[model samples]
Target: MADPQPARRPGGRTARVRGAVHRAVTELLAEKAPDEVTIAAVAERSGVHQATLYRRWGTMTGLVEDVVAEVLNRGSPIPDTGSLRGDLSAFAVNAAAGLASPMGTVYLRAIALGVGPAEGAPDGGHPGFDARAQQLQEMLDRATARGEPVPTLPDLLEVVLAPMYFRALLLKQPPDEEQAHAVVDRLLALTRG
Candidate 1:
């Protein structure tokens, strides 16, 4: 298992520390390879002690996972736009916008390439994968609650997200609004009753 996210205390000392740490991680990643970003460097940039980083993050991979999580979690929660089509469309468009960013591309590549075994994951699965799956499930649950018939998780991944991720991660191209709308329309046509 990955370490749980830090307890959020808005505008408090803890939040400030996490924000500083996240900023340091972003700056260092922009400057160097993921493999070269060390706790000492992060501490130096963040003004948070190395000991605090070690105590909180446990390992380099743990720190990386947190950094990915923080970046991905910012700005939005999954869309809940009343109608399933509307929600999925909003989600796809927002996601495409995110993947289009340089930092977003770097973060995705790092998580896909560098994430591996950590303290809680003895079986060696990436927690980021698990986190993404959970997010997808939440979206499906929202759709179901809205009385839309949702596809199973595997089908959702295959039919809905696969094209989006393939274009964003593999082709290194973000979908335009028309492309995003097409994806949402196709998925809704397939799954909606």
Candidate 2:
């Protein structure tokens, strides 16, 4: 029998290329609107061939989806600060900071505008939103495990995340720490009832 191929390591050349491409996309999104970020621009910025980009990502939407997923996963890691309040507060603050950033604003608007998959996501949802929902659920599960009174994911989303997103994406006002804390407090108050 022919020798089986070795499993591909994550830190290989492929990962380097992906990292470069993602960084290039991020920088471009930070500097300009999502509509202005083209595959050719990414190719030039990343020093990777346009053919390579087309072969790997298939489309600009695909590339944006990948970048959004990577950013959402890496940017705001779920906190484990022992108490629900601390965790929620930390998460809110981090989320506020991220949403306030130039790249964050672009990506969040992209996600909100459904710039990713057309359909067929797990639970018939956008992958970026699903990933964030999963992260929120993980935090809620941790709080439950600690015997803490936890609010529903919808409640958290409505009371905390929605306002931040609205402010950043619609109002053109990224939330500051004080606003984040106030939102957290509002969520906590609702959960206390």
Candidate 3:
């Protein structure tokens, strides 16, 4: 008879280590600048070995990218309000609120500074951007499935996301709910034309 395969543990040691490391990174980012947070500091704070961090994330940028992705994903889930306008409006408001937070500001700065190339980018593109793009695409796909008119990704980026990001990251003024809704309305209007 063939040997039985070992059972996988979802919340195993590997998961614990990653959780500790991620928590450490987030705390450090809250207290200090991205450049000030280092592998040694994270190792000491997380109680995980420096070698383990290096083995898992490759570099500070890699670690930051993972943290940013996690933060965004957890903070702003895709809404399903049964309409494209409702979804985008909720998404925009949530996104704006996240960006307006202290941690969000830190994340925006890290992204703006171009931490490093993403894991699979051949030309050194930002992974955070890629993650957001995937999120937007998912939302668009849902809208399309519902027989709703959807703007192209570029149009969404330019009309909806760009303005919010510009106001938050560049202008240091995150949009309020009214402004966010206006941005969504503007994007929806584009689809009508």
Candidate 4:
């Protein structure tokens, strides 16, 4: 079991507990799937009581959501490079890199599993699928504000993102500058098409 007490940080007690729990869950994810991971594992890893894990996150999904939310929050920092092309290229590069990362892929796959079905994904008609499409739309809105006219969000995602994820996950290839440029150019063409 981990220490009964949590870290004593300047951010105060809640911060300390949250940090410990986050670390514990992160380490657990390194070794196991999110579905297989348990609250007891986190509690033992953190040296905190099982009650603490239950009280804090309530359930495995809750804890996983917290971790995912944190990951997304940090991952999608606004990319403002004055020009929409520059901003999108930067976003593509970052997205490519993230899809190739261990933590990022896991969260993505987990989220996919939570959705209704795979077949419904391509059409964006899944009952409970959450592709974070809103974030992409927000990016479009920001671009529009910058004088760029972007049509549907899926077109952007399919042309710019599909290839990145396809290569990163399916092809088992690393995300490189060449791939990022390819996606960006394709997306740029789509904007005109």
Candidate 5:
């Protein structure tokens, strides 16, 4: 039979441990490459034991995955500016700014490497793509609730977002303010058409 689940502890030692671990992971990612951020290193930095990290996260990949998820959720919050265009433009600008940052580049590279070639990924795409897409869908859902005419998911991801990632990853050019707005305009036109 499976072992019993651990006892619950709300906002207690469990929370502190998780916070310390996450904070250590974030600081390490800012300073070092993803591969270099080992469990031992995190343990040393956070004062948490290596055994605890292994037991809680299973491995470095698991820890990094959770770290990236928290970063994405906290980093790319959906802005509500009382209009769809304003919201989309804000989102695009924020995304561009992140890609332009040194630590963001490192984090994204780590995410890409970790996700690539993972089993069951659609079309061998990034493993985190689904989660990212879900975040975008939630943003779109908010816009829809405000009576905005949003494009289909395929159109939003493939047509609209594809260019942004291409510029950041392939061209090595993260969009400036004008370029970000232009992307939003292009998407607006496509959705309108």
Candidate 6:
């Protein structure tokens, strides 16, 4: 078996402290607002010391931002399938698969708290929720490689992601192979109409 990502350590103690704070605080914010966040709580959840949380984060806002980075960075990259339909099916399955677990549902709900109905990213900027969106968007890029123009990314989201997530998050349904493949089927039907 090969490691999908090679583990690399930062050379500095400062970087280590930063990483610890980021992980700890993000875990804390998984269910609560930054104001409700406490150093003791972060320490208890992350196994880091209260001193470290205080020294590194300096303030609640700092802690919150660092944790936000960690949360946004936690997602794995989406797969590429060389066609909008195939790639979206893969993306839908991948995204929905995670939403099936309790931890996954909790994380999804936590993120939803921070995200309002908006365009672009969860952060309200165009950078768009770290690389997960880009990885997902790559599925559309695959269409161009096959001589078809990739549709608008949001439109792609509506057709592929909307249903998958809605079912998984709101209905507590796990996406099966049939349901995953239906994303592709639905998109194809819509496009042909």
| Candidate number with greatest TM-score | 2
Q: Tell me each candidate's RMSD, in Å, in order.
A: 3.5, 4.7, 5.5, 6.4, 4.4, 6.4
lDDT of 1 by residue, 87-175 (tens): 77887787777767778766776576554443445664444556667777888898788787887778766766678778877887875
Question: Taking the tens digit of each residue's C-alpha lDDT, what string does model 2 give over 28-79?
Answer: 8778776788999999999999999898877777677777766676765787
The candidate 6 region of ten consecutive residues with least summed lDDT is 1-10
lDDT tens digits, residues 1-193, model 5? 0111236464678767877988888788778876788899999999999998898877777677666655565566667787778877887888777767875675566566566454223564333455667777877887799898997767766665667778877788875777778878988999888
> Which TM-score value belongs to model 1?
0.75
> How should the candidates be ordered by TM-score, best one leading?
2, 3, 1, 5, 4, 6
TM-scores of all models?
0.75, 0.84, 0.80, 0.72, 0.75, 0.64
Model 3, 83-188: lDDT tens digits are 8998898888887777778787767865655433444456744554666678789989999999999999899878877788888867778768887888899989
Please give the TM-score that candidate 2 achieves against the real structure. 0.84
- TM-score for candidate 4, residues paired by index: 0.72
Model 5, residue 127: C-alpha shift (Å): 8.7
Candidate 2, lDDT over the whole model: 0.80
Better of 5 and 6 by lDDT: 5
Question: On a 0 to 100 scale, what is the lDDT of residue 188 in model 1?
Answer: 72
Superposed model 1: Cα runs more than 4 Å off: 1-12, 117-142, 145-147
lDDT of each candidate versus the true structure: 0.73, 0.80, 0.77, 0.69, 0.72, 0.60
Winner on TM-score between 3 and 4 is 3
